[model samples]
Target: MSLAWNASTDNVGVTGYGVYRGGTLVTTVTGTSFTDTGLSAGTAYTYTVRARDAAGNQSANSNQITATTSGGGGDTTAPSVPGNLRSTGVSSSSVSLAWNASTDNVGVTGYGVYRGGTLVTTVTGTSFTDTGLSAGTAYTYTVRARDAAGNQSANSNQITATTTTGGGGGGKKVLGYFVQWGVYQRAYHVKNIDTSGSAAKLTHINYAFGNVQNGQCTIGDSNADYDRFYSAAESVDGVADTWDAGALRGNFNQLRKLKQKYPNLKVLFSFGGWTWSGGFGQAAANPAAFAESCYRLVEDPRWADVFDGIDIDWEYPNACGLTCDTSGPASFRNLMSALRARFGSGNLVTAAITADGTSGGKIDAADYGGAAQYLDWYNVMTYDYFGAWAAQGPTAPHSPLTSYTGIPQAGFHSDQAIQKLKSKGVPASKLLLGIGFYGRGWTGVTQSAPGGTATGPAPGTFEQGIEDYKVLKTRCPATGTIAGTAYAHCGNQWWSYDTPSTIGGKMGYSKDQGLGGAFFWELSGDTTNGELITAMRNGLG
Candidate 1:
């Protein structure tokens, strides 16, 4: 038999392809085509292919095709059902699944593992680690085997696994963002965090927008930062801020009390967001002074007890965010090193990074790997790969786990950027996958799938082309999913966002890839009941 198809391409060229027949892997060849002999005539064969590059990154399986021999005198019997399927162990985020091997007339190719009756993935081995499960949740798993002639066995005995209760234990973490501007029109205050039940679910909360100004970390909004008074009704614990001598007030005070309530919750003052990133270039010029200013401000005596650490959110060290920064590549490493030195090893030092997932993209413009040692772990802003920025958009999901066929751009997917970072020597355990708490859409979308023509940006509640997941979940509701993200098209609008189910898939991907954890853009984007955040915690736990 002979097979040939179009060649697969990678940013770093494809190294080889794995050819599979039924459950058996036939061969891994470097060429685009493969030929096989010794097959009996008149037998049916199912084939699929997977491409891998030098970096050890494998592409998703290709479309399956069928071929038949003329004689039909080959082994046509299916493999026996895999037996003794059992759960070896379970953790907050993962379950260990194993089963006895099956016998086939010819040879068993591999096994298919299912979770809750859905085929989550396929493996050549007898055991699989199902990751990104909610802690304390029960799950059912089954396995089946296949023969070379395209015959599949019956499902194995199902076993239930009850994951242990806990968040990502040890140094692993689940972090969330609480925006400073959320208090304005959004009416989402630090108090809302308690009401939403997010405080208990989070390990850390980044109080965003400690702006970078004049090459130093400074308060972005005085009124919202520590001046605005919260009424008794707006307070987190139902207690009002006092106006006595040496009285602590505003959101800063509320956050302090919140920490007291949730002993393990660490709040970090995040510096330099999209709008306030213009000062990063100046700060990079003198790393020490920048670090010193941050230390003093973050450790201010008035709110010293409030913040556990400093989170540098410089939009881009050597690239661009709100404004362009021409700082050299070495600047990011220098800034982070200085901050780490000043903050000391005991404090939690972190950074929110860019996820420009293209080859020679913004990620290549900075020295993240060199600076990884200085950070607890990087918050890889993996979302925002595509949006309705182009008035006439070839619509695509903002956060795609892998590139799909006919994708608009190359290297603009999550897995590619992640694989690039991994190839650049950034440890997977030090990288946290980013999830957007919102969706990007375009109006006048005629077709639903990606690469469809669109007229202009979709109308959003806050900004054009963007809307909260909470709103999109109801307004449009995901009609289809691709590359592990959810999308919906209602009337003239086409929206793409991560739903709970999609988030679960991403969480599984994170676990399989050995990522540290997952974090979203902001908390207010979730439902009032915290459904999305709950999904994240459940998947990552």
Candidate 2:
């Protein structure tokens, strides 16, 4: 049998070639080709070639090639072909591939690699690392294995991969949320992104609530995603959204434009919110199908380029949020693992999780630690622990950073939640402390401090008990601080929310804790000057 391949290079140059039959070193040559004699006439054999430098450092084995003789042989059976080939890590200049090991009657010896239809190299292991490739190039790969008896197997499944354009979303990871419904009643157009200076500071944005339904990921609002047209004034650059040929019209197109100006800002389509979380239980039952549907939806051709990945926001896993979930304790872990496998290594996968840090509370409801391996990071919702949901009487700051004396609930503050999550083996670098850009308040309050008496939810401009920071700062001028958050009393109404000062303090704690970064509930709640966001960015630095 004879085998030939392109030469491998080192710091110096290729000096010679070493050939192997099955697993044993057979012969050495100073040329790129090799030939073997004295084999049985009717038998099968496998061969791999390796290059050696003048210094005697041997290169990895070359791609395996098999041949069968016309007569008989002592041990002529070939090993089974490699299977389950997939790409794991990838970058502009390199790609990493792995596969299931092949089995053989006489034991598999080595595996051969091929890239772009040409023999690249061979390896004794089941994985190969292809390096020194061009950036932004598309490559296809396959592998084969040989038995110790010198019998070669056929090619494995082919895998197509492309080098990433750049790298993973890096830097300090200043993530922010962009609410889809804000475009409607809130009138927070995508143009506000530029006006508020959010596009410049943000490294990634989560497009909120894509909606999980009927065990599949779906868009929360079709009109808001791709159909809502922007007027010339409302558009980011003062240009009207066109209905021209192949023109996209909604938030998706606007985000695409925002990313054009701020190329570093990656966006992920976040599916599921408090209202849409009921379907997550159903999703966990068939996670692979759910992941595939989500991948297709996120990569939809019309505005595929707008998003970098997907975010799973199951309100509570194995626990109750808006609806109860009976999916076992391992459900969240299984669901997330499937998502990571299906999404592959090229894109980011994240989740927005609950922050109930009390003993046997929301934190104990799911396997967040097990799921952490699959996530880029988690947005710890550190707010909403207390609000008008309980109705009358005691009023407390909804977003307390610390557990203050006389606090109504234990482990209901931001610091408690963050520390609890970190204790569960979640790296602080993979936890983004959540901040609310608005205030939660109560009406009919007499005392100015937190824990004041109140009748019911306050009369918000839009919602009953919630109002934007811009409005709350002036209307309910903060008169006191409790648990590291601000509160105020104006007439008979009382409200508690984070001001710029409190936000600075929170960001400082986030830095001190070595967190990934801070992510707020939304972008629209800040002042027109981007007050809270500016404080967060500077404090993080």
TM-score of each: 0.73, 0.68
Q: Tens digit of lDDT per residue, candidate 1, span 167-237?
A: 54323467899888899999999887888888888888889989898899999988888878888899988
Candidate 2 lands at a TM-score of: 0.68
- Candidate 1 stretches with Cα past 4 Å from truth are 1-172
Instruction: Assess each prediction's global lDDT (C-alpha) against the native.
Output: 0.82, 0.81
Model 2 misplaced stretches (Cα beyond 4 Å): 1-171
| Residue range 1-541, candidate 2, lDDT tens digits | 6677775667855556788889777755554665564466767999888888758898787888889866644777888889888775454566567787898887876787888766666556555546557667899999888665567789899999787564321126678899998998889978898888878888889998798999999889999988998988888767888888878889998998888888888999999988999998999999899999999999999988999999988988978888889988998999899889988888899999999977688888999987899999999998998888767848888998876545778668887676666656676678888889999888888877567777899988888999999998888888777666788888998888999888887876675555788899889898898998888888777
Whole-model alpha-carbon lDDT for candidate 1: 0.82
What is the alpha-carbon lDDT for the whole of candidate 2? 0.81
